[model samples]
Target: IDEFWDYDEADRLKAIEISHAYRKSRGRSRR
Candidate 1:
């Protein structure tokens, strides 16, 4: 259970990082 939770947390962080980068790129393209 602990391992599973750790994996999930890592995935969530990675997803958030990707989302942030994507938004930044989109914002630049819009301008």
Candidate 2:
């Protein structure tokens, strides 16, 4: 259970980072 939760947390963080980078790139394109 602990290992599963750890993976979930890591994946969530990774997804958030990807989304942030994507948003930054998109914002530049709109400018």
Candidate 3:
């Protein structure tokens, strides 16, 4: 159960990173 939680946390972080990068790219394109 602990391992699963850790994995989920890592996945959430990764998703956030991806979304952040995506937004940056979109902003650059808009400018």
TM-score head-to-head 1 vs 3, winner: 1
Q: Rate the local accuracy (lDDT) of all candidates.
A: 1.00, 0.99, 1.00
The per-residue C-alpha lDDT of model 3 at residue 26 equals: 100
**TM-score of candidate 1 relative to the true fold:** 0.90
- On the 0 to 100 scale, the lDDT of residue 3 in model 3 is 100
lDDT (10s digit) by residue, model 2, range 1-31: 9999999999999999999999999999998
Q: What lDDT does candidate 1 reach at residue 19?
A: 100
Top-TM-score structure, candidate number: 1
What's the true lDDT of residue 29 in model 2? 98
Measured on C-alpha atoms, candidate 2 has an lDDT of: 0.99
Clashing pairs in 2: none
TM-scores, all models, native as reference: 0.90, 0.88, 0.89
Model 2 misplacement above 4 A:
none
Where does model 1 exceed 4 Å of error?
Answer: none
Per-residue lDDT of model 3, residues 1-31, tens digit only: 9999999999999999999999999999999
